[model samples]
Target: MFDKIKQKIEKAKGALEHSDERVLASIPETSGLSKKDIYRNRYNHGVNLGGCFILEKWIYESVFDKGGDNEFDAVSSQVNHSSVDEAASKLTKHYNDYISKIDWNWLKNEAGITSFRIPIGYWHVGNGQLLDELPFEPLREVYSRAKPWDILKNLINKAAEYDIGVLIDVHGLPGGANTDMHSGCKNSSPSFFNKSKHIDKMVNVVLPFICRDACVNCENVIGLQVVNEAVFDNSAHGQKSYYSRAVAALNRIDPGLPVVISDGWWPDQWADWLGQTNLAAKVVVDSHVYRCFSAEDKGKDANQIINHLSESISWPRDRIDFVVGEFSCVLDEETWRKTAGNRDEWVRKFGKVQTSNFANVASWGWFFWTLQFQYGDGGEWGLVPMVKKGAIPRRPQGSPTVDENRVKEIINEHIAYWKDKGGDAMEHWRFEDGLRGAIADINAFAQFDNSRIGRWKALAMQRRAQYISRKGDSKYMWEWDQGFQRAIDEFGRY
Candidate 1:
């Protein structure tokens, strides 16, 4: 791979006029594996590169905001230009500076992450976002001048140099998908809920990554997320029909390409829908679990928090195929103040538990919310800081493993039962096939103490009901709890 890249570099030098984009695109993504390889029972051990491509909500005031409100406001105000060309020029400098600050090499080689999530706004297509929504002329001029999408494409290709996969996340939709500024506009009313065409527009931008031609492609440019944090009510915004439309469109393009969707406030609701759908195998649900946002965390300690996370969130979460999209080791301000021992040790312990629970429960693993953004932005909550300080592990551990010895025992027991019951009929069953089948079952159920889906349902309901009834936040809990029960019904007793 190094030799091939060196040769490309040498070739590019000869052809001096070849644009930087063309020169960078020449590097080959050596990983021969497709997107399916990452999602098919493989845990996603990764970090989200937030605030690099898009000015994220968390990083907005710190980085993008000089005096303005959001990314759009800040860029326009900072540039303060009447000429579109001048605005674009200044924006180009700012865009490149942020991208340059990221250490992709360290993320891959040192951090040991398998994937990186690149968040982009819908307007990343170039100038416009939607028909009557968010004109963004000032930002548009800059994007047009910088050709930011091309730079992003180059970054995707460059990441392939270390065989790291990229999850293309459409962070900001046309009108604000949610009340967040990251959605481009800060309108509390979700303008994206009713807009079907906007979904189409986002998909149009996403097609290239998943549907590469026969010649050049990056193996690690794995999949595309429709939108980042969509506002989901019973309405179309975050519900199934909304996602169904996006999923159907993508499947029409390529059914094999993995499509990731944020649970849109109700992860428990989609459990049955995803498992039963034709798109189940190709779809991934993203559930952002954050304790910092609510007033409820003010009273809880680390032990109470971790316990609640395990029983209510993590264990029940195992019943479905999902990933903990965003998480941080930073406890609530009050919790932090009351905690004892080394703060670093506390962070390490919290991070370890969080990662362990996700690996053991969620079908795919977790991604730490961010790498590093500003100069000194990473610490307790940041992935790079946790890694540098040894708070989080570089590479994630394997899937929630089974007791190999116990599995062998179960297999031997099953084999003996078959042998006793079937005399001449035993010849029908191949020894290897029967043994492998028995072993697989054992591995599948060992996480739940060798119990199958039927028993898992009973226990999950009991545990979750107790949690929700006792201390569940969110007024949406009742609806989601019902949805969780419905999912259990759909899967049925295995």
Candidate 2:
């Protein structure tokens, strides 16, 4: 395992150092006026930095035992401390190592991905689902109130060096957005939707970093996703009405910035829901389509498995606007067996088909599930290995020139509109500085009691209260404060 990880990191280093000389003989055509231009000028071709910040979707038993599902799990299990100071030291080292592993140069130069959707858990912020709850306080007191966002913030700035834009995705909400362990806790009945505090915490988690959230801003961040996969069942809690509240809150924070909402297995319903809210064009829908998990695709042969997306690949383009949030080339076991002869050919063809179909039809664009996972396993699903194999084309076609003068006119008009409303206009995403300044600005916002956020906070509170009534188990994870103190006090070395 150690050898494999070492090899992977070495390969990434090599790619970063030599990809331009080896594969990209010239500046790729996709390179141009990008950064914030990516979200509007052309469809975004991107990749997700999954399991990086929020969750650890890994095969390593050690990581699981260490409880990397959420920040609370990680701090409680991985740190053997006799004091708060010691625990903070361990967490700082652990988190820094995790975020440092990201190879931003490779993502931009090697894979040629245009944008990045980074999944961040709410705990990584100062306040999560509920600021006053257990499992949440550790995040605040331990990490300098979420100063660790420096890594992600740096990545965003580094991406601009390659002209790549980033989409800040809050993959995990407080109390678990979905039943998946990726949401921080695995439970059949997701508590995220069952409680109102979860929604409030989500607002807390998203408000900063938003270009319009405060006077501070992140320049390369083109989009902000409220939730990853908050499950949608037949119950009222699963309905799109809940998303509307989230949408309303985010819009109130940054009306110009795109607030991406997931399709959540209901394409037409979500499209209709957003349309009704008059935010259809203003916001983008995220639909994660996968064939590997479905019983319908499991029994199919290689051809059928690869061609499954052909039927509905163009659905969003034809009907509404949306982005394929996640997708991979992995096939069912039956499909794998049928491809015994010439495995490489079939794999390449499948990847090309999915890749082409998505760019052609995914209205907003497509993000491969991940750039890489499990240290260096850049397997069939990993964009790094796939790009190396040439299964995925890294050369993005040159898009049409954007009307820069028209854009300026629109911005000037928008600023005047806001100025008329008695609110000082913000720099917004296109003009703001990158992550470092954004983080410092946010920190100062807290310290100085920034008054601009009053309106946004009031709107968020209204939405949280408007949604799910607070009637159930108010004391879930009630012992966090005591446990946090005990964890700090009980430390005397491992």
Candidate 3:
């Protein structure tokens, strides 16, 4: 069985290499860039961006702000490091301790999860607001001390214990990934369109971590996801080119490792993006389905939701595999509202759409939204919580109910089941035959009758129409939209 799995891995690798050829043939190389040329390679495949840095909202705020009764007060209360060695020592213990508390084996074995998305923090690496120039070389001292490779070694060691892969994602761009989260620089203005400035600093400061020995090990480190959810409304061409250049450079250091390119919120954009010079062959397209964020699923049912996923894959289905990247939904109205402590039904609805539609996924796995979040849907994420603020009594989600032991049991069962069944059977059970099982599950629950769901969805649709009228053209119609309707149309009454 192990030998078969090994053979399958070899075949898949070969297929992946050949797929690059096909994609390259379909797309032209950037001028002067060759297959062996690192700058020429511009594709990214694999899972990335869970928690760390920008995603750890509470931690960032708590540790950095001088005024709050925050958890990171002591850590934040120090003079910034003067050298790389000092920075490493300052963060090494705290960082190592954080990972040690995690149930790495359980996360790997039970969650059917592989790949850890570690985010790099700007301040931790010494590029604070005081520095005002490009290349951010002043950060070299801080970065040198912070010991990212050392931390990565520890993370990889733990991950290898469970046979998982690791993908390092640079989360905070210079101006910040978006305006709402601020970790990269002070006076960190929004960079929806001005994100190009990040490339210079990344090349000088961030490239070493990628080229280092700790990162080259394939047994654990799989690839580098350049940045998390790059906002494409700004610098689309520069972002694409920078990614291509980064891939080429990294490939120079480690040829076998793939690079992951995260597209803007709209993944469909990549269909045309693939034909761009130096990008098609080295990329795995990424899209995030937040019935909440995209508002793409307003009133869709299980089958309809799945079909939407299938349709979304039409362009890249043959050439590039996509990562769902993030997804979560709320199922029950009353429970959701009570849990959320407000009327953010859209978020809940999106979660439901995702849970309902996940099976039809062509080639994907998810990192889920965060390790933790603030606001009503707080404590919701990849089975853990970061420091708690916004609500009192900070606690892990499901707490006593969703303990490590229970989560471990769930994750282990899934991992073992997949391992024993092997990827093929797992794929069949999940994609081919799973739809029938899901429909039957929904149908079996008398309370969730199709007719009732339809009526509820209709009312939701009516409200959305009214809302859209007031709001103007928007994608928020969600499960109530045409993408979902087509799915129901195909599934045919019950």
- Highest TM-score, which number? 1
Question: How far off is model 1, as Cα RMSD?
Answer: 14.3
Relative to the true structure, candidate 2 reaches a TM of 0.67
TM-score for model 1?
Answer: 0.71
What's the CA error at residue 23 for candidate 1, in Å?
Answer: 48
The alpha-carbon lDDT assigned to residue 144 of candidate 2 equals 59
Each model's total of backbone clashes: 1, 2, 31
Residue-wise C-alpha lDDT for candidate 2, range 394-435, written one tens digit per residue: 754332222436435544554565576642534322211111
339: Cα error in model 3, Å: 12
Clashes of 3: 31
Per-prediction TM-score to the true structure, in the order listed: 0.71, 0.67, 0.54
Candidate 3: worst-modelled 10 consecutive residues by lDDT: 444-453
Write one digit per residue (lDDT tens) for candidate 1, span 185-207: 66667776566665555445443
Question: Which runs in model 2 stand beyond 4 Å of their true positions?
Answer: 1-41, 57-71, 80-87, 127-130, 204-216, 235-239, 397-494
Q: For candidate 3, lDDT tens digit of each residue in 350-414? A: 44344334323323334555543323333444233211221111111121111335433433454
Model-by-model lDDT, in order? 0.57, 0.54, 0.43
Report residue 418 deviation for candidate 1 (angstroms): 9.3
